[model samples]
Target: MTMPFRLTVLSLAVAATLAGCNRDKADETTPPPAASAGTGAVVTPADAAAPMAFESKTAFAEVSLTLPVAIKAQPDLHARLYAAAVRDLREFSEGAQADRTEAGGDEGLGAYDKSIEITPGAETGKLFSLVRTDSEYTGGAHPNSSFAAILWDKALKREVAAADLFTRTGDLSALDIALCAAINAEKKKRDPQAETVSLTGSDMWKCPRAALVPFVLAQGTRPGKAGGLVFLIGPYLVGPYVEGSYEVTVPQSAFRSLLAPAYADEFAGEPKPEHAGA
Candidate 1:
């Protein structure tokens, strides 16, 4: 609900909101916010089903969220969506306000831009995910950035937890291991001479198991009927911040035994082994 990670620092937050982050890099890449679908696109009942809106008193941060416009819209649709949007905006407002406080007088506290989008892949809107990103520079030499994602089953009107995608909680444990292996493998392929990655140890290990659930949720854990459930890690989560966060998608077949009834039919699409490599 409140954002899953702090864009200001690199921590387990990528996996589930690490408590600490260091070094505010000047040129971190920020994902572009989603734009209006505009009035020109063909309209359908589904389109009318989920209407998105935003509110911002200043240019610092804005929230883009979906709400039910029809009287017959699902019972709690508007409430749920609005609640999610508000949570994000609150986090943004708090972060910006904190930066303003640091300004010593609240003047030109640098720029903070936070954006959100509900419908992705240009889908029919029946199934969508929330994509939120923030790029902020609060008087620092550079900016801090991070992206967070949470999938919503429009039809079900509930978040699709990482555990929800799999058959059981333990299945996620297996997935955590697979994800780490996949991420480290990605690091290796990108730079054969790159440092070894591990999330289990501090000094040299890449990440911690504690970050697994939160990281998965923040990564916008979503199911691909044709592919597999995908985990989009932000820059620096599993590697150096310079390396950037990335998607470590696995094939549906990789977890065929663990697929939930919802996505048990999926059988294609595995991220290219080298896809996450630089």
Candidate 2:
């Protein structure tokens, strides 16, 4: 009885193997179906998520948001960033359309464009710092550009604002002074004829409050550590629109004591040479 059962199993296995081989042979000879005329192009996940432009007789608008490859490697972070970009683009496009309608321009309004690019700052074991620059034009005399910082916690998989990394008792006044000095120096270098503005002045030309400005972590000589902070001062913040934007970097040594205990170790050394004055 046992021998008969074993023989039956062997016969079934051989039959299955022969059937699989026949299918493979048939598949080899069978030509794959051609893609539909309009569907021939392949779209990757990133390509599918690319920002779309809005064009109409009344208005034309477009947005471009770019992220670093490293940031895109994280699924949750990538999705959040992409969703936010899409939302912003959508809002801007809608607003442009509405403005055109309100203006009642038969020839259509001017085009609106917004471009955002995110670059890597410092990528450590526990944190990833990024800098985002935004250039936008919305019926203004000239396009305006600004900067923003995004700090992501690897363990928590979420964004951590720069303000949260400091202690409650941290003395940011010193950092402010440093930033003010740097701005004045850069201003002097750019236009020797132009006079440097006072930090105590209550005008647009006065030095901007460091805490209020957007800042990103600067890369340090030591691997896996932040060298310092780079304050992003947009036009009209610290000076006239003609002065444009400024990237002032303050070394970590200047703000070492101001950092919270948990974040102190994340910073070390000085700003890389390439990022020093620029």
Candidate 3:
């Protein structure tokens, strides 16, 4: 009985192989690869998930000041102000990168990989950004978008204030570390008992998809010499992991000469003009 059953199985296998061979020979045409369901795009997941990394090792020149001799004479204050500006810009850009990572920004090249620069001018500041400009929608909307865009400032002091976010350390880049720390601090301030918000979604705690960090410093007048002002900087993230935000403050006082106006906006929803390139 066992031998008969084995023979029957072998015969069936041979018949199936012969049938497949016959079908292949009968097919005179080969179909093209199927397009994406919604996009009709031919690219595959491997094409979209390619790794991307950016770095700037060379430091751009110091920010050119538009202030008169009086403001320029205060070297210490000038240095501080310039440093603050660099720090703020670095933090802002890092937050942008983090947002992409949280949202799996690589879904499109336009939103994921980009560069933003800050240039100081005679009066106002300048911003420049370079990124993949392609965008497409599946709902039969705009297709085959712009290839690239060159955004520039019309009335700024310079083109962009340049700084180095890349560091030799293996850990997070300077900007990334600064943003993460700042956001962590802000959350602690809000809820002392909460845990470090991870990249998971939960009640009372969902991973924040959009987060921002703001740092503002100021100088004040003193009786004899200009005293240092306040040093306020913190980070906050908002997304699917967490609903609220967090902050960390490094409060200290320095000479008034060590102050410069650092303009950095820390909002989650607003689109930045840096990449817009007007």
Candidate 4:
């Protein structure tokens, strides 16, 4: 069986690290390769580089990303704290009191099933959330999907709520664009044969259909680790900001909640297949 893309890569890289702890950190010093043909600028780092992986046991997908200096390698001010927040959220799912089931119609795909959303707020700190969702097939031959969301601090430390998190950090415009390009480059390497390229908003990329959307990178430190954080950079969709338009007109609040600690939750409940729509 094809393991979730993230978990498979995570296992390999974890094994590699355990087998040889002395290997140089990939993101610390090495320079990343040039940007794709026409996406954006490249990112490099200040320390030695190392290998990193993102995985999910239920998603049947795993992706390996470089820890090169540019984007993944930087030692942000809040990196350690952000990492802890991610770990906490992951733990929350295992012991959460509320496990509500919700479903709704989503574009591209019809309905999402067996989902739970959690919002966490801290006194004098940022806002963040944990969300877990699963998509199952009704008639079409699509494989089931499980996803988690997480938000971290500016330095990438403790996870915070969306309400407080953004206020504490700088505008993510440039960072968002740079991250999309980096992830796009990684996907290209993973599936060099993948055809077209489409970038929308900030981070989404149409690796196959040329559809683009906003994307973001979520980084957190490993549980009990000293100086490193796990980075999950991928395609994400967000509401576009229009000139002279009210921000409240869109679901920015909900989307932000889905982005961070939301990734830390668990979606291990057995999924129930439902009747498809006509």
* Candidate 1 residue-wise lDDT, 110-157, digit = tens: 346555544332112344444455454444555566656555565666
TM-scores across all candidates? Answer: 0.58, 0.76, 0.21, 0.27
- C-alpha lDDT of all candidate models, in order: 0.51, 0.74, 0.31, 0.29
> What tens-digit string does per-residue lDDT give for candidate 3 at 96-188?
566557766546444222232222211112222222222222223223222221222223322222121112232323333333444455556
Q: 160-262 in candidate 2: lDDT tens per residue? A: 8777778888568988888888888889889987667776996657887777888878878888888888788888877788888888888888878888887
- How high a TM-score does candidate 2 get? 0.76
Better of 2 and 4 by TM-score: 2
**Which 10-residue span in candidate 2 carries the lowest summed lDDT?**
50-59
Candidate 2 segments exceeding 4 Å error = 1-58, 106-108
The global Cα lDDT (0 to 1) of model 3 is 0.31
lDDT digits (tens) for residues 1-278 of candidate 4:
11256986787787676657656655433335754424464432311121122222222211111121222322341233234434543443332212212222222343222222222211112222223233333325443433344444423345444333233344445434433344445444455754323444334433221012211222122221111111222222221111111101111222242223433221111111110000
What is the number of backbone collisions in each predicted candidate, taken in the order shown? Answer: 13, 0, 35, 64
Q: Decide which is better by lDDT, 1 or 2.
A: 2
> Which sections of candidate 4 miss by over 4 Å?
1-133, 144-146, 150-159, 168-170, 195-278
The candidates, ranked best first by lDDT, are 2, 1, 3, 4
